[model samples]
Target: MAYETVIVEIDEGIATITLNRPEVLNALNSQVFIELGEAAEELSGDESVRVVIITGGDKVFAAGADIKQMASATAVDVSTNVRPSLRTFNFIENMHKPVIAAIAGYALGGGCELTLVADVRIAADNAQLGLPEIKLGILPGGGGTQRLPRLIGAAKAKELIYSGDFISAEEALRIGLVNKVVPADQLLIEAKKMAQKFAARGAVAIQMAKTCINEGLQMDLDRGLQYEHKCFSLLFATEDQKEGMKAFLEKRKPNFQGR
Candidate 1:
């Protein structure tokens, strides 16, 4: 689909969502959120798309929210205005297919929150990620507060958010915020490689695993285990499961049709 602020390209089974607007460092705005949500929704229903990658081109992921747009907002306006971004983030987080963040340059404030929604994050060596809303006399209105702590750790998340300090891509990897970091030129290549790996897997199983992990996080250990048991048992009814076992015994790769 064509979008004014973002571009969605599907090649093979991998869908790439590029955050356009390099002129402003790809700042997050209301229009961007709406387009992103629409694109994500469209991709979520596409059976051909097995995995997705969200990037801000090669130069920058995004600097932050459009500060100028929010400079004069009142409390009521601010409260109601953040719904689009929050809704978009939630859609991305709940999408069945895996989503990867291919981050380069700065992914600050809203941009960092954006990456938190992805299943995996691969950063360029020159990337800088942070929640710098504190510097703007605001806090991360997008899922940053909840997701960041769950991802890295409360202490580390708090340090970065409170101080508004941008961490290098290496530091982000060390803290487990990012899965891998490569040279700037290789960021998209690595991200697409990871996406391709996911594309090759059993689609139903991958979706189930993502559900178990994401939903299980909100449950206690006992409940989470039960939920996983149910998901595992349910998978036995799929055609892919039979093919997978048969292929294993025959020493051949199982051809999954995403059934």
Candidate 2:
């Protein structure tokens, strides 16, 4: 499907969503959010695509939610819009297939929130990340409140959100907010490499692992253990698991049919 705010390209089991609004620093307008949801759904449904990358073109990953649109939205209106954005963003995180956030330039406010949802994030060395929602007398309406703490712990998330200050990629990595930092020119190169590497793995096992961790996060300690065991048991029933083991013993790469 075509999108006005972003471009989608799929090849070699990798799907890329390019934020197309370089003119506006790839700001997250309502249209962008809707299109983002559509793009994510498409990537998830396509069996040929094993990995997905969300990124901005050249200038910026995103400057965050379009303030122009935010400026005109009332509290109720804002709530309605933010809900879908949050859902789509979280959907990306929860996707069975791994999603990579390839961030360059500025990833601020909603932009940074969007990146926070990815299974892995690779940022340009000079890229800037911050949650400056407090600067607008608001908080990170997206999953920033929930995901940030999970990614970087409570105190660090608080400091970044409370201060609303931009931190360099090095700082973000040190705080455990991102997986790796690369040169700006190598951002997409490295992200695609990682995505393809993940795509080459056993899809079912990868998906199950993601589910186990996500479900465990919300459950109590005792329940989390039960949930993890359930996830572990479910894997034994899948063909991919059997293939994975066979391939390991045979010293060959497993061919996962995503069963």
Candidate 3:
């Protein structure tokens, strides 16, 4: 679907959603948030799309939220305006398929929160990420407070959020915030390469694995193991599971039909 603030492209089982507001350095606003949710929903329901990537051209992932849009708002107005974004972030985090973030330049505040929902993140060497909302007398309204700590540990999360300091891509990688960092020009290529690798896997197993990990994070270790075993046993009923094991024994590539 065509979008004013973003671009969606699907090719060879991969869907790429590009944040397209170069004039404002892809600063996310309410409209951008709504479009992102719509695009994510559309892609999630598409059977042909095996993996998804969210990017902001080569220059910048996103600067932050469009602060000017909220600078004049009252407390009640600000509360109401952020509801859609919160819902959208939740949807992306729980989506059935894997979601990858391809980040380049500035990714701050809401932009950084957006990346936290992605299953994997690949950043360019030029990337600068942070949660600087505290400087503006606000906190991350997206899922940053929750997911960031889960990803990089509570102490590191607190340090970054409290200081409002930007971290280099390499620093982000060291903290486990991003999975990989490549040269600026190779950002998209690396992201697609990783996506292609994931796309080649059995869709059913991948979905189950993602669900197990995401849901397990909220449960005790024993309960999480029980949940994982249930999902593991359930995959045996799928055709992909049978084909994958058979092909493994035969030393051949398995053709997964996503069944």
| C-alpha lDDT (0 to 100) for residue 22 of candidate 2 | 82
Q: Return the clash pairs for model 1, or none.
A: none
After superposition, the stretches of candidate 3 with alpha carbons farther than 4 Å from their true spots are none
Q: lDDT of candidate 2?
A: 0.90
lDDT of 1 by residue, 145-190 (tens): 9999999999998999899999999999999999999999999999
Taking all chains together, each candidate's TM-score versus the true structure is: 0.99, 0.96, 0.99
Residue 132 error, candidate 2, Å:
1.1
Cα-based RMSD of the predictions, in order? 0.6, 1.2, 0.6
Which ten residues in a row are the worst by lDDT in model 1? Answer: 132-141
- Residue 127, candidate 1: Cα error in Å is 0.2
Instruction: State the lDDT of candidate 2 residue by residue for 1-259, as single tens digits.
Output: 8888999999889999999988889989878888899889988999999999999965689998888888878989987888779778878889888989999989999899999888899999879999999999989988888889988999999999999999999999999989999998988999999998998888988998889888888889999989888889999999999999999999998888889
Error of 2 at 209 (Å): 0.4
